[model samples]
Target chain A: MQPVIRLEDICKIYGMGDTEVRALSDVNLVVNTGEYCAIMGPSGSGKSTAMNVIGCLDRPTSGRYYLDGIDVAGLSDDELAHVRNRKLGFVFQQFHLLPQLSALENVMLPMVYAGVSSAERRERAAEALTRVGLANRLNNRPNQLSGGQQQRVAIARAIVNRPVMLLADEPTGALDSQTTQEVLNIFSELNASGITVVMVTHEPEVARQTHRIVWFRDGMVQHDNMRPADLAQMTLTV
Target chain B: MNIIESTRMAVKTLTANKLRSTLTMLGIIIGNASVITMVGVGQGAQRYASQQFESLGPNVLFIIPGSEETRDRTFQVPRTLTLQDAEAISSQVATVSAVAPQLQTQQPLSFRNRQSNSLVMGTTPDFLSVRDFGVDRGRFFTETDVQRNTQVVVLGSDVARKFFDDTDPVGQQLRIKNISFQVIGVLESKGAFLGNNQDDAVYIPITTMSNRITGNTSPYGTEVTFISVNARDEASVSAAEFQLRNLLRLRHKVVNEDDFTVRTQKDALEIVGNVTGALTLMLAAIAAISLFVGGIGIMNIMLVSVRERTQEIGLRKAIGASQQDILVQFIIEAIILSALGGVLGTAIGAGGVMIVGAATPLKAGISTPAILLAVGVSGGIGLFFGVFPARQAAKLDPIVALRSA
Candidate 1:
């Protein structure tokens, strides 16, 4: 299998002088291309830290990070930004949509940073918003949209530049059960279309929707429930 | 992101809070207005003084008795110059074109039932050209009028109007110090000089003034007031002044400091210019303090804005923005605020200058360099003051920023 992300003994420590806290230690993980999975854990289990490192937002204290076969651990801050821009898309629990911009404009932001031409950026941003079922709400601001719709807009923004992997941190943590299902369905549809989706969450129900689950406890991986049937099915479908 | 995108975002953010932006710009506006107005008025006053000197005479110099140090110490200038000195300069100095020696006294004048205290000046026929006065009616007294000691007077316009009731004052009789004199000519209007009205004085023959009026003639060839001398041309003024000084020192037999001081129009204008220039500088410096305060106001607001928008910064960073990007965005916001303030202040200051020009005797014009300077300074201030808050915002950890909000 072609791997999309490979982590070797990653460690992240915070503070020093006897107050040092190891947020992550010896965390080895890998996800294949086009896989739909979730990283699940309790509070302080370092799943969030793992997500940050994988997304290239934070560097690990000691580790080897190979994102899409690119050695990201040795990357400088500027190079990491380029990796984040081209290799990964991020979604937060808070639905971080800039309030001043319209839904379409918010979706256009990543492509703007990607140095995409304005005409193409607009066309692709509109297409991404259409894919998220937000075609009609493209001009609406974040405050005017419902919570679920805002999350959908954020999804469109994350995917507008056509990233290789979508990394979500508690993506449905703030939503009602009905909207949670709606967002999860969108994620499943995105995965079926040949995109890798790696999600971090404490909710078992959210974890169950994914094909595989990696559980963490006390700064280390404690469980891996990768079903062979689901993997075969994922390959066959894609 | 490009500068254009950053600027666009900055505009959007600033326009969201219109009241705060306008209030922040008020200090710069007032500062610019005062600077423009004070400088414009100062320039206008200088121009007005130069015009007054031009109207005095063409290439004229005043030979005042005594040194420059004691010119203002006494009311009367100690009569060290004489009518004979003026004649000697007119005859001997090749650069000298004309010379008019003046003798002055304040005396009550009467014509029919009207009576008033008036300034009476006794001068030669050369006074007509040397003092730039024109005879509006009849004719000025001839040189024979002084040798014969004829009691003939030329009335100034205001004096003519006061004593003769606007009737032709020529050929009329007027009494000065209770002595009857015939008005042979009437002078045209000459406006105020150094706050003293030039149109209220009457002119007479210098010999008649010494013989019949003041009767203060001495053996030193008739004591007189200042001598007004006109050079042959503008190029000859300094040469004539130097020659006159040497002639006077020899005539007065001075071995130490010279007894007479020659004053040029340029010298008087320089003194007036220095005073007005200092006044303008002081006023502008005071106004610049307010501009400085306005820059501090921008910095204060930017700091508060950075704190309030921490989450936004984190979001931008999370979405592929580098630290440099965040820094540029905040810095652009501050620059937009200050540059916009500068433009608005310039418009207001130009308007104020025009208003002051319209309402007062100072015909102040809007100075282009002043506008450019004020605007450029404010923009630079925005850049200078903006660095602190922009750096602060750029340095925040995205994890902490996202967590805080």
Candidate 2:
């Protein structure tokens, strides 16, 4: 598989002088296409910072980032937004589905930014919702849907643009175990369809389900490709 | 995102908060309504004044005492016009057809037990034609009546009805200022003009009125209130006015600005139009302040809305909406609110115009250009005031926004 993402010496700093906060320090990473990976870390470990950078929500203070083989280091904010729209899909802890839009409309959003015609947007949104097992719930508002259903709609929205990768941060953190499994199953199915999935979760049980784990501590990766069985039982710390 | 898409989104968002949206539009609604109604009333006043002036009789002109500047600042008629001026106009001016020298005084008149203070107009026989009055009964007193100082009076229809109800007013005698006068004629009913009932006064000879009743005679012959002159035809009205002014100036002599002013019906109508136009402008300017205030209200509400919808902004941003898209969405929402307000206000204002037209003497109508201007201006105000708040929304940091949510 080709490398969909490569990071070289990525550093993100948050303040100046004595109050300076380094969210990421000399972070180097390479994630391949179609890889299902989990980034695990405790509080202030910079995993969220990495997610932000990888999702192109924020720019790095220093270093080069290549997404789908194109370096994103020198892109403008608008250009970066385009990259995010076309190449990356973000799923958040709260699902973040727009309350004003229906499931179908929410799924149509990225395509709207992509400037797709309404008919095409509707058709593609329906197709995406159907793939997420939400064909009958296409017109339901976010408030009208269950938590699990809302998360599915969010996932449908994320994948509607046919992005290269899915970037989820604590995606199932607000969900119960039953809904979490439903989310994990969808992620697995999407991964099997040749989409890379990078998720950040603190739960070892969740991390064990992924193919690879990158654990962070003190704004740096303490371990890469670690398996749960290789760790000290359920200590859950790197 | 395209404009259509943004507009659709804006409509959805605004509809989701119906009360807030309606409340936000209240200012624009009131502002537009005032703007429209004020302009309508002003136009109506101008029209009424024009009608009243035109009804003074065809091709009529008033030679009033004092210069134009003096009359504007004072209520005192300068007594510069008299029978002499009227006689000179009727004889010397070629464009003149008839002249009515008028003197007016409110006097107590009694026919037996009916005593009332009524307006008494003193004039010669020419008052019938120059003032567009018709004698309904008996003949009007002739010019010989003024020469003899005969105490002959013509009763207006209203005065005839008041003093001699159900009986013929002609040949009846009425006492004015303790002097007895015989009614020789009755004039036809003339409708009110500018709030004064034209058919509610009595007419007498100017010589009898000055010598026997009021006893206020001037050495300059007769001090008439104002001289009413009619041009030979409609085409001669302005020419007549120009000639009258020149002749008066020559009579008064060595004038810098002249002591008297001759004005046509058209001039009076123009003066009325200017006054009403200024009133309309003042009203519209006040209404504009409200519109400006409404625009500020929109900006204030939009700023709050941006704050309230920060999470939504963040979510949309994360989902690939650019800053420009968010900006467009908010601005479009403001425009929709304001334009809708304009339409509603126009409806209310037009209804008010119709009601005013029906209930009052003013025939106010809904002006089309005013409607267009108000609606266009409100829409423009929405766009103008919406920019800062929309920019505030578009410039929010997505990461911080999401974290707050």
DockQ of predictions, in order shown: 0.50, 0.73
lDDT of 2 at A230: 63
> What's the C-alpha lDDT at position B331 in model 1?
87
Weakest 10 consecutive residues of candidate 2 chain A by summed lDDT: A229-238
lDDT, residue B237, model 1: 91
lDDT of 2 by residue, B162-244 (tens): 99997998898899887899999999898787888888899999878877876765556678888889899999998899898
**What are the lDDT scores of the predictions, listed in order?**
0.85, 0.88
Model 1 off-target regions past 4 Å?
Answer: A226-238, B66-80, B102-123, B137-186, B194-196, B200-225, B269-273
Q: What's the true lDDT of residue B405 in model 2?
A: 53
lDDT of 2 by residue, A67-184 (tens): 9999997787778788989998989898888888899999999998899999999999999999989999989999999999999998998999999999999989999999899989
Candidate 1 residue pairs in clash (backbone atoms < 3 Å): none
RMSD of each: 4.9, 1.9
Docking class of 1: medium
DockQ of candidate 1, scored on C-alphas against the true complex (2 decimals): 0.50
Ten-residue region with minimum lDDT total, candidate 1 chain A: A229-238
What are the fnat scores of the candidates, in the order listed? 0.48, 0.58
